[model samples]
Target: MTSIRRRLLLSLFGLWITVWAAVALTTLDRSGHEVGELMDAQMAQLARVLREISLTDPQPAAKATPQALSAVGHPYESKLSYQRWLGDRLVASFGVAPVTPLAATIGFSDQEFGGARWRVFGLPGNAPDEVLFVAQSDTIREELIHFLTIQALKPILWSLPVSVLLMWLAVGEGLRPLYRLARSIGRRSAERLEPIDGDGVPAEIRPLTAALNDLMERLDQALAAERRFAADASHELRTPFAIIRTYAQIARRSGDPAERQAALDNLIRGVDRASRLISQLLILARLQGEPRATGRGVASLVRAAARVVADWQTDAQAAALTLTAAAAEGEPGVVAVPAAALGILIGNLVENGLKYTPPGGWVQVAIGSGRGSVALRVTDSGPGIPAADRERVFDRFYRPPGQAQPGSGLGLAIVRRICDLYGLRIEIRDGADGVGLSVLVIFPEPSGSPKAHPP
Candidate 1:
């Protein structure tokens, strides 16, 4: 597993080392340049002093000691060399004097002598042909530059451990709040869905905590919906179960064959009602957990409505209701919903319309496409719902007052859930001529059609 702290520390250390290395190299270069300039100035100053002394004494001692060339008790004293000449002949020599004649050129110049490279300064003596040369070995100058560079870089080396410790402390302090938040969340139980306290949270971490709190809130809502579903399912199932048992008992105890047959028929109806209620409840439960549709599945609204109308035509005929399906001027576009979900949505709307309409009433399923949207309309010539109870009918198990038709009250609720998942718009209003109910559903643009035909 990767660690944030470790990666942060590694990145910081890498940057720190890179900067230090650059500084060290710059310091070394600057130190070498400055020291070389200073050493060259010293060589010029030594030549001037030697010139004055040679002019002061026209005649000098034949034997010259090595110490005469430079100051005693100095670390680089032995590396110094000098040559004095008069009338094109060597007069005195000291230290590692070269055997060959020194260059006649004046000022400082690099010359190879005494089997070593030297920085030499040439000066004219008092006599026309007289000259003085003072020189230092290249190795001595390099050693001096190396020593000064080390001294200049010593502070950075000494401060490294202290700086690293401070950096580690700062990084740890910066991440302490995140660690605390993790611990706080880890301590929470599944049953405890209270919002996390954001009072002391850092501004950088506020977004993370806010998102987590939002997720917890959604989870809490889902759990509540599940609980309500459980309670409502049990309550609604109890009535049908009791009714079925009573009918079965009556059928068993009745003496007349006609009475027995009636009880048996009622028991069969009760079982069917119970089964339909269970199926609708299961569908609602499945849809409750889906927050949104994938929008990849596509289905034709016209086709789905036609299929639903066809499936219920027999029932409509038996009830003396006029059931018909039609499409508008254009072929209805595909909708971004699964074929099964489309079937359920249209099936529920058609069933609900037929259930409420009276004998000889007409129920219509219309499909149309316009303005990049698909509209599915289910209208019935039944007694219309009041404006006050229109929205309430979409709530599960909700039924308007004085309704004689038997229903689980979940059809419209299931329709609403599907519309919400697929981002469809639903509107309820009076039917044509203001006689009954009309539910208009607007579906968004089509994503695409499937390669295979929709089921």
Candidate 2:
């Protein structure tokens, strides 16, 4: 596994090392130049002093030895040498004097003498043909330069350990918030779905926490919906099963054919009601779990309505009701939705209309397009839902007051859920005569114009 802390430290240290190396190289180059300039100045100054001394004392005492070139007699004194020439004769010498002229030029030059490289400075003497020369060994100057460079690097070497310690501390402190967040999530109970607190969270981590909170909120909603579904299913199915069992017992005990027939019919109706409730329940569950569609296919409102109307036609005739389906001429009536979802939405609406409409009443399913939307409308001549109950009717297992109908009260709820999934606009209002219910499922126009096809 890759570690953020390790990666950050490695990157930071790598950059630091690169910068330090560059700085060290630049410092070494600059120091070398400065040291060479200082050494050359010293050699020139010594040569001038030697020329003045030669002029001040033309002759030396017979017993006097050549003065040591380095007055302080330092450890590097042996590398320093000087020579005084008077009229083609060597008058005085210190250290190892070269057999040949140390420098042919007037200023300074590097010359090999006595099997060693020397930096020599030559100056004109006070007398004609008199000259003085001072030189230092190249090996000694290099040793001094190396010593200075090491001294200059001492601070960086000494501070490295402290800097690394501080960097490690800073990295750990910066990552504290992430560790806290992980611990907080790990400590949470599975049943808890509350939003996480954003206070005290680092700005960089706030987006992550916010996304986690959103996920938790959605999970809470899904669990709540599931709980409500389970409770409603048990309550609704209990009544039908009880009724069926009671009627079955009555049918078994009855002696007369008429009584037994009535009991059997009631039992059958209870069984049918229970089966319908279970089927609708399954559909609602499936719809809740189905992933949102993401395909280019278009659903034709006209075609879906026609198919629903045909399927329910026989049922309408059995109920002694008039049912019809029609599409507005010249209207595309096409929407961007899966055909299966559209069919389920239309089927529920038509079924609800047919179930509640009284005998001899009329029901109509119509498809029309207007102003960037396609509308599939189901109108029934049943007693219309009151304005106050209209919104509530779409809630699962919510039955309107004083309505005598054999239903699980899930038809409109299913329609509402499907409409929400497809982003369709659903409206409930009075029918054309203002005496019945009309449900309008308005679908937004498809992104591209698709030819309407039959379902």
Whose lDDT is greatest here?
A: 1
- The 10 consecutive residues of candidate 2 with the worst lDDT sum are 60-69
Residue range 1-455, candidate 1, lDDT tens digits: 99988999999999989998998899889977897899899988888888888877787765444445335567576678888877656777667776555566877889887688988888888888878888888888788878987887789889899989988999999999999999989988778889889998999999999999999999999999999999999999999999999999999999999999999999999999999999999999999998887575787777788888999999999999999998965575578888799999999998998888999999999888778787888999999899999999999999999989888999999999999999999999999888999999998876555423554
Global lDDT scores for all candidate models? 0.87, 0.83
Models, CA RMSD each: 4.1, 5.3
Task: List candidate 1 segments past 4 Å from native.
Answer: 56-75, 84-92, 101-118, 121-133, 244-268, 292-299, 311-320, 334-340, 369-373, 444-455
> Per-residue CA lDDT of candidate 2, range 165-197, in tens?
988999999999999999888877658877888
What is the RMSD of candidate 1?
4.1
Residue-pair clashes per prediction, in order, are 0, 0
**Estimated TM-score per prediction?**
0.82, 0.75
